[model samples]
Target: MSFVIAVDGPAASGKGTVASGLARELGLPHLDSGLLYRAVGRALQVAGGDPDDAAAATETARRLDPHDLEDPALRTREAGEAASRVAVHAGVRAALLDFQHAFAAQEPGAVIDGRDIGTVIAPDAPAKLFVTASPEVRAHRRWLQLKDQGVSLDEILADIALRDERDSARSTAPLVQAKDAVLLDTSEMTIEQAADAARRIVEAARARWETSLKGEASQKG
Candidate 1:
């Protein structure tokens, strides 16, 4: 059996960093589930397909190669918007569902991070964290990241707000924290601080899950 850690959050939150840190601490493989949608979105852009066209978007997702996810372009604002657009299609989401599930079921364990990992992809995961920050704090982080590249803080803030709206309002796999997920608000927390807190949470959750499993085994035996 595999232990799964599902970390879900909106754009620009520290989920990716926290997930990476947690995976390193736990010796588990990590998957950025959003990259799957970004891959499809990039494919659509390359093929001149309309993101709003469900059939086109679904076809793009169905034909996606895992290699395509390695593209650095998927991290761009345009690609993120495209991803949000294509992700609204249920068929597109279904096309990528199995891929995400396979990643989560890896031997030993896995850490998967994205908007819907907790609520949809890995609802039974042993550790689920909903990482978030205020829009202002997240936007500031983005600004600091791209300031040298000539992007404005105001533009980044607007983009973050708009992306949040689209992601939360999407029909399929909307951005929502699962009921049992522990919330990690990083608005006032530094990266090191966030990672420390996350480590504690996952350790506790994993202990509980392992105890439950042992109890079940005893009952069965």
Candidate 2:
């Protein structure tokens, strides 16, 4: 069985960093699932479509080429905001469902990070983490990443707050923590510390998974 790890959290929560690091340590492929949404959003923007148009956003998501995710433009703040808008559409979420599932079904396993990875995309993943940090800290971190663009810290903080509200209030696959997931609050931790804590969590989950497999085998003997 593939040992899938689903990492879910709000924007700027450092879930992506943790997921990528864990994937490397475990020799598993990693998927930054948010990039898929960002691609859809960016495409819609370039086409002059309104993000709130469910049909248009859904079509954009359906037609998204995996290669489009490599576009560096999708990493920008504008693309991220657009993604948040499009993501609220149930149709858009439905369109991308299969893509995420396929990634988790790969050999060995995979590490996937996004808002709904644990609660919606990969609920049965063996290792699930819900990473988070305080809003102020998260805003600060995000500002640091984009300060070169001349965006003010206050503007970024407000944007983060709006995104959080939208994500949690969305009707479809809302951002939430899975009941079985371990929560890692990185509010005060350094990147290295957060990564270390994530490794320990996954290691524990892996051991439990192996023991369950052994128990099943013994029962069949």
Candidate 3:
């Protein structure tokens, strides 16, 4: 029985860093699911497709080569914005769903982080965490990150707000907390503290999964 930890959160919520730390602590593979959407956006841009064209976005997603997604250029603000636009398309989300699920099923277990991982992609995951922070805090975090990259702080804050609205209002798999997921508010927490708390949750879930698996095996035996 493979153990899966699904971490869901909005942008700049620190979920990604927490997920990576938990995965490292547990020796599990970590999948940043947002990368899938960004890959499609980057692909479309490179192919000269308009970001606002849903049909073009869907086609790009359908034909996406995960290998090509490894380009460091995909991590830029422009690509992230483009990805948010494409992510609202149902076809684009559907195209990337299977790849995320496959990664979650890998051996020893896996840690997956994204907007919908806990709710839509890995609902049955043994451990589910919904990490978040106040919108102001999230925006501030994004502002600083972009500022460090030489971007204007005011523009970055406005973009963060817009992206948050778009992500939460999308019809398909909108970002929301899963009912059974543990909610971690990192509004004032350090990365190490968030990671430690998440590790404790995962450890508890792993124990439960092991116990359940043992019971099933005993019944079969």
**TM-scores of the models, in the given order?**
0.97, 0.99, 0.94
lDDT value for model 3: 0.87
Q: Is candidate 1 or candidate 3 better by TM-score?
A: 1
Worst 10 residues of 1 by lDDT: 142-151
lDDT of 2 at 51: 93
Ranking by TM-score: 2, 1, 3
Model 3 error, position 150 (Å):
3.5
Predicted model with the maximum TM-score: 2
Q: What's the CA error at residue 85 for candidate 3, in Å?
A: 0.4
lDDT against the true structure, per candidate, is: 0.92, 0.95, 0.87
Question: What clash pairs does model 2 have?
Answer: none
How well is each residue in 67-149 modelled by candidate 1, as lDDT tens digits?
A: 99899999887788798888899999999999989998899989999999989999999999999999999999988877887
lDDT tens per residue, model 3, 167-220: 999999999999989999999898888888888888888888899999999999
Candidate 2: what lDDT?
Answer: 0.95
Provide the RMSD of all predictions against the true structure, rounded to 1 decimal: 1.1, 0.7, 1.5
As a whole number from 0 to 100, the lDDT of residue 11 in candidate 3 is: 86
lDDT by residue (8-118, candidate 2, tens digit) is: 999999999999999898899999999999999999999999999999999999999999989999889999999999999999999999999999999989999998988
